[model samples]
Target: MDINKIHYAEITISAVSPKQYPDDGLPEVALAGRSNVGKSSFINAMVNRKKLARTSGKPGKTRTLNYFNIENELFFVDVPGYGYAKVSNAEQEKWGEMMNVYFSSRDELSLSILLVDLRHHPTELDVQMYDFLKYYNLPVLVVATKADKIKKSKRNKHINQVIQTLELATEDKVMVFSAETREGRDEVWNEILASTRNDSI
Candidate 1:
């Protein structure tokens, strides 16, 4: 895919309710991660846009499911981040319900890109999200973000740790990503293309 040829991309909707989801029938690739896991940076890097997904220093800033249309081919659905301690239990429950409804019921969802911090082991919430995707039989591609923060010599070790911690299957794909360096962008795009192709079949 030509990242340079991506001419049309924008947040079509910030959905608080499933009723507000776009009905265009385009395949959707969802971004799932804990708060401050660098999902926004990933999106911006993937699309070759600056500040398109709204990066923030604060965690849990994305409270809605943001749908971004990319060249009319597919939608990158940035789901709200999980595991922020500042949010109240009641708010977390609401977020959970919103995510559950979307993940389980949305037919357009082609794949869920699960992001985790590359420097540390996968969090309990990360594991839970991975499990939730598997429970629904959703295709997932694990992306270990912030790869630039870790040394190249230790990258493989960390990646292996993530695989082990997540208990990823042999066939499951994991990409080492760095938004700053754009290291894994091509691989991630290829996975997205393959997932969408399978979804269409």
Candidate 2:
């Protein structure tokens, strides 16, 4: 299939309770990151469909897993990004529990894209997420978002910091991306395609 032609057809809320996932057979690629880290923008960039993922200047706006069907070939699951301010402790705890079940038991989740800000090294929350994915033995690709914000000379340094901090091996994957500039879209597609081949979704 021509990935460049891919467009977002529909986005439906899936498993608002986090207990109803892994039942859908569609291959799932999950996007995870800290709040305001540009995950929704990344999704919009990936499908070449602007505003489909509903980006907001405010953080913690998305609280549920949104599933988007792409040309009937794969599913893009937008997991709510974590660590937002002004969120109640009870709400945060609930979100944490919901995520725990999703990551641990969702059999249909094939690949997880961990989105981090390219201009800054991964934050503590980002590090925890990387460790969590590793502990689960899941396939993950670190996405350094907003690549255009950093200078060319500084990009490698930031990327190296993320790699070393996560303790990722040379073979482990990471991609630099900018949603506004539409960079790294094709590479992200390639990674998603690779995940689909494993038949986990």
Candidate 3:
């Protein structure tokens, strides 16, 4: 569906618990990233909507799994961003507990999309998250955002650092993205489409 236009998408629900999630049994794509990783921007770009997902200057804005229905084809679940030190220990634990339960048990989760900053190597927390998803045997697609901020000549260097830091296998998927230029946007949609196909199979 790369060439086809994706015309419908809307926020179906903001779920704090599994019971609150949509029961339609659609294949879901779960997005995991840091607070400022431009996830909201990424989602809006993918759906071609300006503000389908809210953007905030403040970090750690998402506290629940925000589910978006994409043309009734699949669900995009945006999970809370991690590693914001300004948040209290109590809040972090709550976030942790919430995430643990959601990731550990969600079966409708067809793919996990991990966002890392393209400008820097993956952080310790990012590595842990990647491994955590791997532990669950979930297929992950690592997306490096803010590609336009860096020089083209240095792009491979940044990408390789992410690979080595995460110990990603050569076969593992990685995609560089730029919200400014919308570069790699169509390819991401194609990858999402493939994940949905795999879920159906």
Candidate 4:
């Protein structure tokens, strides 16, 4: 896809329930990650818009499902970041319920892009998110973000760690990404396109 052609993207809704989701029937790619994993930065980089998705210094800032309509061709669903320490138990339960309903029942959901910090191993919540996607038979692309923060020489080792720790299948693709330099942006978009195309079949 031409990155320059993505001129119509915007956040259409911040939904907490199915009734609030868009009814346009566009294929959706959901983004999942732990708190402060650079999901928003990924979205902004993908769309070539600096502030399309708000980036925050604090964790757990995104508490709802943010739907970004990309050129009206598809929707990028930004689910709330998991594994924040300060959130109340009740708030965590609500997030769990909201995510469960969307992941299990949303027919338009074509894929889920699970983002993990490239500088460290996948967190427990990251593993659980991957398992949840697999349990629901949802296609997944695991992205190790913040790649620029690590040395290029050590990147392979970190990527390998992420894969092994997550127990990713041989067929599953994992890309090292950096929102700062836009590294892996094209590859990520390609995966998104492929996933959505497969869903159309």
* TM-score per candidate: 0.95, 0.92, 0.94, 0.95
What TM-score does prediction 2 earn? 0.92
| Native-to-model Cα distance after best TM-score fit, residue 164 in candidate 1, in Å | 0.9
Error of 1 at 129 (Å): 0.8
Q: In model 1, which runs have C-alpha deviations exceeding 4 angstroms?
A: 198-201
Q: Candidate 4 lDDT, tens digit per residue, 1-201?
A: 466568799999999999999999999999999988989989999998899998887889998999999988899999999998999999999999999999999999988999999999998889999999999988899999999999999988999999999999777889999999999988888888878774221
Clash pairs of candidate 4?
A: none
Report the CA-based lDDT of candidate 4 relative to the real structure.
Answer: 0.91
lDDT value for model 1: 0.91
Residue range 158-181, candidate 1, lDDT tens digits: 999999999997768889999999
Every candidate's CA RMSD: 2.1, 2.5, 2.1, 2.1
The stretch of ten residues in a row with the least summed lDDT in candidate 2 is 15-24
Give the alpha-carbon lDDT of every model.
Answer: 0.91, 0.82, 0.88, 0.91
Assess the local accuracy of residue 32 in candidate 3 as a C-alpha lDDT between 0 and 100: 97
Q: What TM-score, to 2 decimals, does candidate 4 have?
A: 0.95
